[model samples]
Target: MQTKTRRSMIIIAIANGLLLFGYGLSLPFFTIYLISQRGLTSSMAGLVIALAGLSRCVSSGISGELADVFGRKTVMVWGLFSQIVAMFALGLCIELKVQVGWMLACYFLTTFLGAFFRPASNAWVTDNTTPKERVEAFGIIRIGLNIGWALGPAAGGFLVRYSYSMAFFFTALLYAVTILYLNRQVQDNHTPCKSRKPSFVSALLSLKDSRLAKICFYVVVITAVNSQLVVGLSIHCKQYLHMPEYYIGWFFTINGLVVVFLQYWATRLMAKIRLSTAMFIGCALYAVGFGSVGFFDGFTLIALGVFLAGLGELIVSPGEQTLVSNIASRETRGRYLGMLMVFYNLGSAAGFFGAGLLSDYVAPHYLPGPWLIVGAAALLAGWGFWRMRRSLTDEEDGKTNVPVPIKKDTITLN
Candidate 1:
């Protein structure tokens, strides 16, 4: 990689690490907080998160267009600044026991603001790296994110012992630290397009491509399955299994370890397979891991499930980014990527909402109901990918004419 490209990747990675540190700290606790402290039912808590997540999808798409218009650094700085204020207010609400509606509004605002960080940063990575370098580039980025994930939850585990509000306060401070560090060391090397502004609706328009749309829909399925990790696990274990808070924090930590240690190698290995095939495999592993967790007892046994899910994430995350990167026109990279994330967040929205309802009405009556339903959805999603492998393989063949700076890796992905 060129030094400048590598430098940008490193900068984005570190920035992502800082950005996600806050997410790791608070997200696992959010569902429980709403239910326990805000006097909401589990379904209501899930509804709030689902609503916020859906809004975030729209904001994420818009952020991409803004990034293309205003530049990556500008959008990121704006998002981070906004997030700091929102998160600080969220902390105060949590600490002060404010009205549920106000507390939720702050949380919703944070989720919307959070949308700004990823598409902009990921687009920055796309701008710097050639197609051949993107999968590993994204892997490098995920490593930094998981590094934050590893530490943040562990720290939040401790903070939650003192006060959950502390996690929100500390996260805001972390975002400030991130902005300060980034401004000093990172430069806005990517230029905004002058030829024409990308339409804000272009992200929506791009979804007309059936292949991309299907994958996006599949993502909704995967996220619905993945939602159980937070929405269901926290409530289930805490209420029934009596799992301690520290163990839940460590669950996230172990998943982060899987990514930090194995993501690069896994990304390379996955690149050797057909993209759709790899996605299918990822979904299978993800489902099996999630399913097994509901039946297990103790932190160690549960960690095994988390470990497997992490491996699934290691493969799937980079593969998704790489597909969008391969298919995107240079000028439209941000919109395409942002479009993919729109579906990504949509999956989270569906997952959170379904998880909430399942946890409330189904899980209590039939403990395995949530996992069984999600596991079924994941397997079905995997089948969708498996069926699409040949078409996806065909699309990939058409995408590779761009001159590669690096030699083709392994079997060239078809």
Candidate 2:
């Protein structure tokens, strides 16, 4: 049974990798497309992304509760199938040169539907792995995720010179293929919680657990900081640094490579330290990486910045995930993760909008301004995590240090 579960874990990781690959191939180009093709201002584009993120946070948070009652596979299929349609429609919007409003509508749908599969799939992973094993397990998943990240942009860089729409079409194709494999090969490994059904708002109640709430807040801040890479980097390089699209793609590919190679080792290292300590360290690295970008010029320095951020990612991300897994009982795992993702999306929204504001208003007067702001935020989040160390614990060691997580859960709406 252990072996089978392990195999399923790998399979799920592969499917997830395919999804990330599609995203890397196409989604990274979204801001660029919106600006260059559709002619939206930087602030306007950022606003669009922020709103889309709002949609994602709500959908994903709600989807988690849905996953708890419905089977993981059921929710996964629903989200996956729907996302494919949205992707194709998005592609058509791009290909046909549709109105900006239509394009925005499709993109919003795609982002919102994208949230559905994640919590369910992640819950499936939690179901299969022991709390002790979750860091390494999530590390494996991250590896799969970054492999696509590594390759997708390099391929996308080349493909975009020809057609941005093609990248979208390719993304949809990859997702379709993943769905086929899922139906044929994968089983619903997670059994649903039988106790009571839940509503979308129920996941928000989990925030009442102060420790869990802290973790979710950290995710928001970090994810926002990380958004500089996704939402701001392209604009920064193209507009300020004067780097071409392909080079930017290459740099992102390298960043993903860093995560892929180092993630497992980082997870192992994180297991030795308190999860909060690891996150604090990771955030410090993020500050150093992203903050330094503002003070320098040229590809080499920027690449260095991206590399440091990647190092931060490989370290904290798995440990952070393990924390959530450790905090939730098995029955509530899906909802717990779902709630975490809500913050993740919210962070993305904050990042997107914040980056745009910095870029539009600040970058013109001070080239390093946007990146410096990003750097400062990263450091602040690191400090926050360090202080929260007492509230968290190490799962595998079976030790309770401080901030013993409250045993009482918030009531879920029926």
Candidate 3:
């Protein structure tokens, strides 16, 4: 890419890494804190976590429209600042032994604000790059994100054991640094805001393009299938395969580290292919990897399952982001992306909730049922992408920028 773009990508990557690190540092022990220290029941803790998921879904589309109206850098700065405040507030609560209600408020605000800037940052990158460069740009950012994921949980584990307050405080400090660094270094693309258009209904209407709508549906399926990797996969490894808890932990380590190491290479490998084709291959890998888990009997095989799924993760993330960017006009990019995020958040919440239910109810009664269901979702998503491949011909022929007029509350793309 250009020197200017490279510099901007580096800054964006660093900012994303810092944000994920802060979030991850407090994640693993959150439920434990609620149940053990705060005296909440298991169901209450789940309810607390569900509130954050709900906030993300509700805020995503709104934030995307705000990004378009207020400008990407402005939304991003404010979003990061909000996260900083939420993190520090949570930390202070831990230090002061504050009530559960205060912790819930802090958590809700953090998740809500966190949803806002993602589409803005993503749109900022989309604003800055051509269709061809976006895949690599997104891949580099994904690598930076995974780097935080790989390291943060381990650090959080230590900190939670030592002092939960310390973990929250350190994470808050990271967010503060990220806010300062991003505000100083990142430049906005300055797409003119549509002053005449009302945002809420308009943002929802941006998905009127049939192609974009289908892609969003496919994302929901794919994300639902992938979400099994976190809760369902971990439980299956420990409960059925009889792996040690430490061994189960290593499965996630393998997944994250593999993506960190191979994401860019996978992006390069898929760069020359059509985006739909890459997505098909990715979804297929996910189907095969997770489906094979049904037959595996040992820790090594489970690790291999995670590895294949990790490869799929590396291939899918950048490909899908590039596709969404290609489909959107520069002016409505954030809104389109935000619409996509709404589907993603909903899918993730369903997937996690469904996976837990399946693991608890189905896995015990029917060993292969949950894996088969997840694999089926992936296959279904792959088929959807294959059917939608025709829509991507425009991007392939360099017609991705063909203007689509944004009417008062609707976008019509040719």
Candidate 4:
């Protein structure tokens, strides 16, 4: 059973990797494509991207509810199916010279469908793994995610030079492959809750648990800080620092390399450290890295800062995820993860919108605004983690320290 579960995880990771790779390939070029090829303004492009995230925010909660009522596997398969359609629609939109507004609509649909899959995927992992293994499992998944992210953009950039349509076509092909892979390899793990259906109202009511609520809040803040990489740092590089376009891919590559090589060791090290303490350290490093951005003149120095930020990301992310999984009820695990993702999407949208507005109005001073906000947000989150550290230690000692079969058969939802 353990071997089968592990094999399933590997296959899921690969499928997820391909899907993310397709998305990553398009991400760096999407705005550029809008601006250069489509002759749209930067704000318009930002709006389109923001709409995608907004769709995720709205759909995630719904997806979680669906996962609980139906089955995680069913929701996941459906989500992947939607992604395949979305990728194809995106390609068709570009190939047919669709209007920018229509193209944005296609992007929105894609993200909305894609958002439904995450909670199901997360809950599937939680269902299959014991508490001790959850962090490591998530870390392994992150490796696949980052690896795809690392390679996708560079490939996208090369492909874009030939034809913009190729980028979307590539995304479509990869997602189609992902759908087939997932359909064949992944198994359904979703058992219905005691109730026949789980509603959004019930999910909202579950937030009465202060610890759980706080974790979700922190997840939002952390995700907001992450937006620094996509929106904040992008502006900083392009506007303030006047860096070349190719370096954007290089920055992601550096981030992926760090995660690929160091994530396992980092997770092990974090096991020795308190999860809250690890989060605090991660946030501090993130702050320092973002804060130093204004001061760095060379690509090497900036890369160093980006790498340091990635290190901080590595430390906090898995630990935070583990902490959430440890505290959440088994029956509502998908809902919990989905709630966290809602916060994540909210944070991401706000960061991009806020940064876009700040950069637009603030002019030359705009570059620092987003980073400073992110740095401040990280510090605030770190402080919140520090306050919660004692509770975490007590909980870890009492509940999470125990070891069990990697695939614990306790179905809390049932």
Best candidate according to lDDT: 2
Off by over 4 Å in 2: 1-5, 394-413
Residue by residue across 1-414, what tens digits does model 4's lDDT show? 267666766776787678778877776677667766887655666666676787888788888878878888888888877777877788788878888778878877877887887788888888888776777788877777778877887677677777777788788788778778787788876576656566787667657767768877887787777776776666667666776657876887787778878988987877676678778988898888776765676899888888888888887777776776777766677777877777778877766666566556653664455567668888888888767765654454223456532223222332
lDDT of 2 by residue, 56-80 (tens): 9989887889888988888888898
Displacement of residue 336 (Cα, Å) in model 4 is: 0.6
**Candidate 3 local Cα displacement, residue 399, angstroms:** 11
Q: Write the per-residue lDDT of candidate 1 for residues 1-414, one digit (tens) a residue.
A: 567677778878888998778787876787777776667887888899899989889988988888877798888888999999999999999999888789889999999998988898888888877776787789889899999989888878778777878889888999999889878877777777776565765567777667677777887788777767777777778776887787888888998899999987887776576667788888888888888877776888889988988888887787778777766667677777788888788888888888778887888888877777877888988898777666554445223334433323221111
Give per-residue CA lDDT, model 3, range 1-414, as digits (tens): 788887788789878888777766775466556755787654455456555766787788877888877888888888878877887888888888877778788878877877877888888888887776788899888887877766776567566766888888888788888888887888787765655443677666777788788988999889888767655665576556765444544565677787789987887777666677778899999998998887787878877887888888888877777777777776678888888888887676667667656766787788889898999899899889877777666554233444333224347321
TM-score per candidate, in order? 0.92, 0.95, 0.87, 0.90
Q: Which stretches of candidate 1 lie over 4 Å from their true place?
A: 1-4, 393-414
**Stretch of 10 with least lDDT, candidate 4:** 405-414
Per-residue error (Å), model 3, residue 116: 1.6
* lDDT, model 3, position 311: 85
Q: Given candidate 4, what's the lDDT at residue 368?
A: 55
